[model samples]
Target: MPPSPSTRSQAAAPPRRDRGDACPGALRLHQAADGHLARIRLPAGDLTVRQATALADAADLLGDGHLSLTSRGNAELRGLAEDCGARLATLLRDAGLLPSERHERIRNILASPLAGLDRHTPSDVRRWARELDALLCASESATALSGRFLFVLDDGRGDVAALGGDVSLLAESAGDGAGPAGSALLRVGDDPAALRIAGPDAPRAALTAAEAFLTAAAASGSGAWRVRELPDGHGLTARDVAGALRSAGIEAAYVAEPPAPATRTSPPYADSAAPGIVEGPDGDRALSVLAPLGRLTVAQWRLLTAIADADGSGALRLTPWRGIVLPGLPAATAPDRLAELSAAGLITDPASPWHRLGACTGRPGCAKSRTDVRADATAAVATGTTVPAEAPTGSPPSGVPVSPVGVPVSPAGVPVYWSGCERRCGHPHGTWVDVLATAEGYRVALVDPDTAPTAAPAPARTAAPPAP
Candidate 1:
């Protein structure tokens, strides 16, 4: 059996949430400086060619013609007219993107982008994601989950599992000598221990754990939107999750020792899958490419959609790395299509400076922004002078991207995020370069996200190391 939540203790307590989360959904639009923004949740990032076309048409007909791919493998439409909400909903409904209006925002689910498509990992996690999504839509009690609440499904590749989800399901290989073949580990919050259950029962176990979180959150009276925010004394453990799973009629075993850590050797939260071609089964291939800064023009979106519709499996998998996976493409034409994508400004090379680069919507889109951070970040990358070739590799203890030696890491090796202000919205989870726009100029420093999974409010600006 797994240890109970009482067995563990935390040093820090997250602040109380006084109000409900205002995260925008397909039906509920968030009013931004540019205009109203709509976030369309795509479970497992799976979308057919027809659905992809619908999104492109919606972008062209309604809001800005650009679709923003989030770090969680979701998409957003900005600069939308508030009155167009009804029309947008109609378009989405017709495209079958909006399955349940009430459960749309809560449908935030991240899975292995290349699961079952390539030979690296043939786990059927996409099926699990779809199953869990349907279960959430049917459960009225699950409507209470916050939009930020995450469900990470990793197909033993350790890609999405390292994302630190509120409820995580890591796929275990068949006959791996761990437990029964085709089983998975269900993790809650930051606790290392997880619940092991049959593969088919993993989705149900995940839902049960989520429902359990809702119950614990209500009892805390803290209005916490996620498990990470359940306060120091309100933590949830694998034992609690196992009991909940049993109540739901799903068999589960506590895994005090989960099969090796689910983290990729390739820098945490960085380019998960390499860019360019990914070899698939039966001599076929898949094209994997990254979007420069996570923004895709309508033309670029259409290009990818066309490839998926004609050359590939008529499907596209939007990865959490702000990239796209075109599966089952012919080994012959896929390379040419990749070249077209590269010419269109997408990052096809893993060594490209734009691999891990990210920026928030600044200037006109956000009223709180002091400058146009997107443009500045772009300009910095264009120059290729963001980092010194001979600069020191080790970073200071306070904050700075550095090399792995002596706990320090290379500054260039760290991802860079351009923030308009201190809020630093949509920043990457791992250590990164903090390029904050100040009154004088850009304040470039190193920043590391809080290791805890809690959703704490942004801290006040404080003194930091000198800019590099």
Candidate 2:
């Protein structure tokens, strides 16, 4: 199970933020040891061929030769030249990637990447994501939101429901003894209660929910940048948010109890040990491609574009799993494309060792890192011993057991993430295997049910000291 909102969003003893969030954006770059880092938020992770190609060009020309996929389904360019911001901005602008400079960082939205293409989804909510993005950008008050604030649009499959969204719009099943058909359940700040509104009003309702949070945060006067950051006594309720929705001309009524959050699990398309081709009901298909360690070279990205151009809709959706979903492909052509992608070093088969591993950019790029975590992760993956035993049920201290350091754990394809230090940046949501770099070596643990690290006394057999 995922952690509660308070546990997930709030650090131990909530710290007040007197300054704005330092999250990087296309316009605002972060100076890293590698170079400048720029994050480009793609609303709903929608990327056209032109925009993707433009990003590839920027990566090759203005930044590093590769693009980094973020866990938010956004893209980041590292090793960026110090003076290339203007050119990069112009290129992104020309490709329609940057719509609002002021609202760029605040546009952190993650939706079901395979919403429309998947058969199990209730309805396509990609349009809702776009509409909500536009609404958020249009609202001048929304500019006050911290870049860390997030919004999630789920297509009733729960794939993205547990991703810690500050505001969430989940689709309700029609004719299932639920209120009205096609109504969206809008909840703010992980509150179980929701504001039920027509499907068409979901975007406006989400915007209104943001406004309500902003209002409450303002009242707290704690400079709360997110709903969770507001003072403990602050109240967030469906009725209050519904009232705000009504003021925004979005008809919403309070629901005493909304449906329980969608189960947090890997999408069916990726439930196996490796990502594979997803065949739709109508013979349409999508090739699920994973980037090794969430890093893609320009040539590899171009290869993806070529595959999409040849076999898909020329559209790719970046997933929060640090992967790319190429939708609208003919079922017949998917197999060949997957083969080609696999041959090109992309993880197309779930059984591949790369299927279970991910890592944060550790050394060189991050000044705080004690070791090159990515290199260590790659070495771990190469050993095929990355999977860990099931996560323990209770909260425990965070560290690996040194008593049985060389014990071999069978492969279960459990998701394992390597972090440079304690922060565990970009770790996957839900229960996952965690490997943290430490002075003693690497500490491996399965994140506890409470989302705290529960480390055994021994590291897995694959644990290796990070390269200097």
Global lDDT scores for all candidate models: 0.77, 0.75
The residue pairs that clash in candidate 2, if any, are 273-350, 274-350, 401-456, 401-457, 401-458, 402-457
- For model 1, where is the 10-residue window of minimal lDDT? 459-468
After superposition on all C-alphas, the RMSD of every candidate to the true structure, in Å, is 5.6, 5.6
Q: Candidate 1, residues 67-180: lDDT per residue as tens digits?
A: 999878888888899899989999999999999998999998999887886766665789999999999999999999988899999887777776658999888876456766
- Candidate 2, position 118, lDDT: 61
**Which ranges of candidate 2 are over 4 A from the true structure?**
1-11, 261-274, 386-413, 450-468
Model 2, range 232-271, lDDT digits (tens) per residue? 7775667779888878788887877676644434542243
The residue pairs that clash in candidate 1, if any, are 402-409, 402-410, 403-408, 403-409, 403-410
lDDT winner: 1
